[model samples]
Target: MERPRRPSFSELPLRKGDPPYSAWGLYGADDELGTMNLITPAVTRAAVAEVKLGVTIPLDLPLDAIAKPFIPSRVPYEHKLLARGYANDDEIRINTQSTSQWDSLRHFPYQSGYLYYNGVTNADISGAEANDKNGIQNIARKGVATRGVLVDWCRYAKRKGIEVSPFERREITIAEIEEIAEECGLEFREGDLFILRTGLVEKYRELSHEEKCAVAERTGAEAAYIGVECNEVSARWFWTRSFAAVATDTLSFEAWPRKNSEGWTWLLHEVFLAGWGMPIGELWDLERVAEKCEEVGRWSFLVTSQPLIIEGGVASPPNAMAVL
Candidate 1:
């Protein structure tokens, strides 16, 4: 039998077929996997070609790296060891999203329905106690082994003499993305995971506690985050390019408490997560991978992420790694 071809852009409104952002019926009515379905067999085969050096590096931050939890609500990771006779067991308690994490299908929404992917209402999430609905656990089985593309915007911007300060809510635009991709001579394909580097994690690690506090104060409402611009152009750009998901080395994928002048609040999240059912990775540790990519003059690689399979869980740390 022949393999199924992915739907094209002309096919809008998923009912006709799979549209640019809507994959509703394309996967199935009961499907919870979302854009991850883009990781087709052909795509996976292509990813293997990137692993020529056999070098591996982790893409996650230390769970307790931050002296203060940026998000006040989340509890810091705690480890407890128990000793019984000569045997000992350990217990680790942490907020799934305290460190590097993939925001699952249930992580965000405008209320229950004003916006949510595939008509997932409040009742749908509530009814499925064990997360028979869209849950992170659903994709945990696959463990996310596929092609990863790094758009080193920070370095690209610096080389171009573009001022990108980590201490401000600077919005990296779509034009920048195009420029960086062109500079790297990379053409993205469907289901490819995008890892955007803005030097956020690097600076955060370098700053003193007082300096960190100053930045947090200086950034104002959302805390100064360097990330992609939140706008329709950017959202459409990502959707049309067929990105499976996007990860960033920043506090939030977009600036915090982010809103465009046009009043599209968290537009990327509203579109990508709430509308398209795509995963969003935040605060990934990309220093080592970035360094490796620079040394090899290559950015794409075989990336893998395995999240904890917790039913009804909102988010989980990305046990993510890159093989080059």
Candidate 2:
């Protein structure tokens, strides 16, 4: 299906009675794939041209990369070996969000009204009648093969002699994002995955094992990291760019200590995931990919990812890779 031309940020809430800055009903009432609908056949065909070197850069951290998950309640990954006639089979269990993951439309909701994307209610996702509406399976079934634009904020800050502390509340403003895109020679396109490298994984590696575990112990307000500035302006920029999804190396896609939006880490989450049906990826290991981009003097590549096809699942690890 051909997607309609996106309306400007000023012309949001395309449907009457919907929240401001939302694109409800833009795809249709029963739309399961939100912004992902933008990943059309033409877009995928164009992205294939970006695979010049055939070098695939893995974007996922090991399922057990983190000794402890940032959310204390989240269970760490466990692998059990099953032996059968000298061969071994493994049974792995994990909290999808404990590592690199794609937060599906079901993960967050319109904070004010408790509505998910396309008006999916809490009961619609988890109750006696809960179905696969807005489930991660929707994305998995369609798959993701598109162009990915990398905005290396950490590298940009270093070039400008700025100290970027991933352990603190650092904000990358919209202006900075625009500037980085320009410096990286990128032109925003529909269906492009906006990838931000905040150097969080790099900093995480620098911490001692004890420090690493402690980092996960901190919860809520105590967790802080560098990330995109989350507000109406940033939301507008992302919507205008028409990104299929947005990913970051930071724990939170938006800056921590979310002092801007009245304690909400990102008001964009409401407008994007719950309102626009765009996915948000977090805790991606971009260190190596950033190095590869630098080596090739290019910031854009062909990215492919497949989320676990679990019906009614809220999120899943993005088995993602970039081909440059």
Every candidate's CA RMSD? 3.1, 1.7
lDDT of 1 by residue, 194-252 (tens): 98999888778888988765554543474666778887678768878887889998877
Best by lDDT: 2
Worst 10 residues of 1 by lDDT: 12-21
Q: Cα lDDT of all candidates, in order?
A: 0.79, 0.89
* TM-score for each predicted model, relative to the true structure: 0.89, 0.96
Off by over 4 Å in 1: 1-23, 111-115, 127-130, 213-222, 261-266
Across residues 138-216, which tens digit of lDDT does each residue of candidate 2 receive? 9999999999999999899899998867888888999998998888788989999999998889989898889999888
